[model samples]
Target: MARTALALREAESAAGRLRSELAAGDEAATRSAGSRLAEQADVARRHSDGWGFAALTHLPVVGDDVDAVRRVARSVDVLGADALPPALGVLETVRGGGLRSEDGGIRLDTLASVSGPVTEAHDASTRADRAVAGVRSDRLVGPLSGPVADLQQQVQELDRSLGAAEKAVELLPAMLGAGDRREYLLVVQNNAEIRSTGGLPGSLSVLRAEDGRVELGKQGNASLFGLSADPVARLTPDEVDLYGRNVALDLRDTNLIPDFPRAASLMARFAEQRGQQVDGVVSVDPVTLAEVLRATGPVEAGGVRLDADNAPRLLLNEPYQRLRSNEEQDAYFQEVSRGILDALLSGQGDQLELVRVLSQAAQQRRFLVWSDSDDEQRRIEDTPIAAALPRDEGISPSVGLYLNDSTRAKIQYYLRYDADIRSLGCTAAGRQQVVAEMELRSDVPDDVARLTEFVTGDGTYARKGDDAMNLRLYAPTEGRLQALTVDGEPAGIKVGQDGDRQVSVLPLTLRPGESVRVRALFETRPGQIGDPSLQWTPSMEWGPTRATARNLCG
Candidate 1:
């Protein structure tokens, strides 16, 4: 027992020296001591596994076996307790020298943080060594090898204690270390609308804003979007710590795997190693409050891909087609769909894809836009009616149209159709309603003047019992239509099919106030009649042609 106590004292003295060397920055000397300690610890562990501490109970005394065992047990415990102070002291000295920043910046470095875990692991290993040594010393000079059965019993007890200490030592390194060192990713989501209401939470501007800078100054101001917390600017350092304790008060704290100072150092080191500038921040969003958060990564590691344009495609698997609503479409591409499409079309041998959407201001008016690409330029071109019409194996038009003389800009090729109007989805008021349909296009420089001449001048024809057309515009008055008239005639008349509702119809051939029977003319059998003409009457309108259905009998 005396020899065992002297050996433990020597080990404690060596441990104290190693701790002092580490504190003095003599890592080489400390490492040498640590290596020797590891070797001794391994030997002690082996001895403990082989023989139980009860072996210590049986000192090398030729006395009653039970009495010797009790006496040895008490002495061995006293020696172990004395060894603990030095082991624990060494651990404290190394671990107390926490991270230090050479750069004098808030950002942390991994090297500094790494030193702590290394020190802790080394300390744990040293303690584990002392524990093993105490057990072994008790066994070496003790009367443990009494009976074969008694030796086995002592060996079992020593094995359990050694296993626990070894496990603790092994786990110490892992627990001391920090998590992944990288910049935190933040995600902000909002509605795409006429105006952006919400802004990013952790951006540099918001964090640096002074008091009252983010306030909504006026009553009924809809700009701020009802979110009003500035966690970054408002939280004090102590408050930040309280929040981070378990709740992770700051978003930045949650991003870090280790403590704050260590985490900061690690992030800075990671940035340096990767050849980039890295900043750390946390984010909060009231909009997506309930979703399980996923990491947003600026770094492209571990099969993570996130970008605004590309990210949406991951969720929507279908091929990208332009959406139909004009307001919605404009908001998405910032009203640059046309310019983008034009750029795509200017390339060599690239096909242009047109996405058709409805014009919001006018119902049934369609417009075509294209997606942006770096390829070709696309321009809207107008072709003659004869060539633009679908080809038939029959007689074609005789005259060739030239681009220089055509009214291309006046006639939009893509005419939008609204199902709601055409389908008459709304309930009708009576059995009798106006129903008229015509197909008319204009090439005149002034559509209103051309329409007026036909409607109120000597050009219109009307037939008795062949229902007349009526005019109705959604506008409050017909002042604009009247302004386009020459000599007292109104231009641009609106037309209805039959007379239960008022619609305007144009005249095919007639003087003012003339009455005649009306029939739509068609060249069914070409070159068959006089001047190749059939009985024709005119509508009162020269506006864009529309198909209308109405009930005439009242």
Candidate 2:
């Protein structure tokens, strides 16, 4: 028992050091720590396998405790022998700059080589988590019990980290085009000009990748493929009524679908009309781009040096003033897109930092991808990168509140919004009641009325300087709105149903420095406390600020 405990302590110590080394980008130290961890884990496994220890599981009263220890010992051994090594190997390759080769192509062969090991690591880590959970703390006693529990929790966390790392390694190759040359429509969404999924598809870039080399192809403004006045595909009554009569018009209205797969298909169809055959769509808002820039350093595009701090402003808003005509602005947009892609593919930046930033963006739903390949799509199906609203009844169901500029102008750049949801309690009928609030503020300067027509609209849809917005609030598929109020008064907004969600739309106008608050009460059909997640349009200067609610079911 003493030897087993000592081995666990040494193994945990090594894991902590390994994590620290990885974070600090010290490849040599990380490899050393991984080796030490494996040695300590072997020691623990051998000590735990003693004949006397195995017999303890057959003894009365303490049998379960002994079994729990045995489980944890096996888990640690598997983690050290099968999991950490493969994960460490991948990290080592990434740190050594093997993700991208000298010619700026991804190292596909190297990535594919690690996929088997990483997948195995993931499976082993999952088993480790089960083993740890099977431990029964009640049977343990005194000082040893506390230490054992702590060790169990530590091991669980380590397993989870390994699982995440392995998933990333296994997913990247397919995403970057492993077997065949892949073509995808890259949407550079401008949140300043709000749309459903995120923002207006201000510009589009074609991303082509083969083996491991990625190249950015032709780039153009979304408007270049002029709106197909008629629906490219059939639209539901609710979609037509809420979005418009034509599906083409809703190509920029992605958030309306909530499900990225449907949205990507529509966007792809729109691209097809303009002679672009894309296998999938990848969307990124300015905030996501800024996060990437934070890792890749500053990039020069159209004679402007864009860094993390000013990327949103320059990319989303400043174009209106920097260029004199819409044509010039479109060209500039293409140039910026090309420059950013060049910077990324040049492999001059910190690869680890890029991975970390992109992972965080995916977790936040800032970067989304949809592929036509069944296998590729399957890998990201449940992940945030898929950008699908959750429909699980037992888990937290998600609610989305999104905005689109009705004025057909770039005025959304001056808009800011905050959203929050609170759980009230479960109803007697087993439904969950939730209160959602969204506050929007327009900070456009009074002088903005004098700006060019490009900054405002043609003044037909709305006044030149005022902000006109169509706000859509969505409830879980099994949920319904109980009541709604705008600015302290009952609002008579249009309510409709789309897919499995209940939708409420409010059209409003806000002048410079004006703010409006909209609130609603809703109930989800039994067995669910709404997942505390609130989705909104990604903004240039302001991303959606959110507040979560406690689980009322508990």
Candidate 3:
């Protein structure tokens, strides 16, 4: 048991490091970590499969405990021998020659070399999942049982991670334009001006990639697309009624659709009007850029030196303060973006850091992608980068509370938000009641009105120090809102539907140094509420904030 426990711990730690290394694009480190994990797993398998352990498992009292040890050991061994080896092989191949050449062109043949190993790794992960499916923690007893159960859980998590990596590797070649050149529209969203699908689209760029060489083409602010007087696409009655006919007016509001595919299509159509055709779309918020900066080190853009710590604040807020005219601000944004892209392509910074940063951004939903290619999109459909709302019936039901700026300004820079969720009770009809409360505060200074027009919107919408917001609380597809209130008073909430989510929108106005709390009572279909997860638009300066919840079912 001790041997198995120690081995599992070592393997888990190594696997984790391997994952980090892979995300960072550090092939050498990934291979080293994988090799270590493989060795540890091999030792664990031998120890657990020994004759003494086999005989002990057949004995009466501690049979279940020994069986648990055997199962975890087997999983670790499979991961090391079957899964990690193939993945390591793929990494080794990339290290040898698959990446971009000295001339900045990618070698298609080298990338294609990874297909075999990726397929093999995926297959092995599937087998590992099957091998551990029947291993149940409830079957074990005694002190060793808890440790064994934890190990089992860790193995399962590792399997899921490995599976995702395999899928990504399988799809990356197509995404990188292995067979043909691909053009994608890239949107830089400014979270200081929040929108439903992350942030308001502020700047746009065309990204072209063929064989491994990537280039950024024409770039401009969202306003250049020009707003349509009429709706650009067919709108659901709910969409028409909630967002009005203006939903299709411009690319900035395209994300009001919630579903990224719909939003991407709308943005693409607008781009086509400007003579830039794209096969896909990618969106990243300031937070995502900040993560990249962390990897690439400080870079000078538009005469401003931006490092990881200051990039978000400078990009999101400083522009408004430093630039007097919209054109200047737009030029500054374009320069910053171009500078960063050039640095990344130049291969000046650590490649491993870039990969790690991108992976983290995708995990946080700060980066999203949509493809017109059915095959390519299908591969990413279930990934977080797809930015799709929870629709799988098998997934635990969740309540989504998102904030969009109705102020039509960058006042979200001053807004702070907090949320709490509680599982109340279950009805006889198998409906679970949940309560969610959200609090929004504005820390804008009373003197903010004196700032540049860019920062305050110059009374284009609201006063400088006031923030008006459209707070949206969405219930699971099959769930219903029971009651809603603002600051302990009944409030009229606009209810609408976005794809599969039932949304309730509440308009809020917060003056400088003011705060408001909104509460919602909702019901979900059936099962006990698992641990609650929170999702929100990425903020410019805030790192990550978590909310505490109560599971009343306990």
The whole-model lDDT of each prediction reads 0.24, 0.74, 0.72
lDDT for each residue of candidate 3 in 41-136, tens digit (9 for 90 to 100): 787788878998988988886786687667766776777677777776766655454455786565556656776777777677667666665555
| Residue pairs in collision within model 2 | 106-212, 196-255, 197-255, 396-531, 397-531
Model 3 regions more than 4 Å off: 1-18, 21-73, 92-97, 126-164, 416-450, 459-463, 483-492, 509-521, 527-534, 541-554
Could you give candidate 2's per-residue lDDT for residues 126-166 as a string of tens digits?
Answer: 77777776565535644235545655656655665555556
- Clashing residue pairs in all predictions, respectively, total 43, 5, 2
TM-score of each predicted structure versus truth: 0.18, 0.77, 0.82
**Candidate order (lDDT):** 2, 3, 1
Query: What stretches of model 2 exceed 4 Å from their correct place?
Result: 1-89, 116-168, 223-226, 253-256, 393-395, 529-532, 541-548
Q: What local lDDT score does residue 154 receive in model 3, on the 0 to 100 scale? A: 53
lDDT of 1 by residue, 1-554 (tens): 33333333334444455444543435456566545444433343333333453464355543234333333333333323333333344334334432212221111243343444444443533443433322322223342422212222222322322232233233322222234222221212111100011111111111111111111111111111212233222333432332233212232222112112222232233323434333331222211111111111111211333232343222111111234342432243221221222221221111110100101100110111111111210111111100111111222101100011011111111111111111111124221111112222322233233222212222233321111222122110110111222122444533332112111233222222233321111111121111110001111111111122111111
Best by lDDT: 2
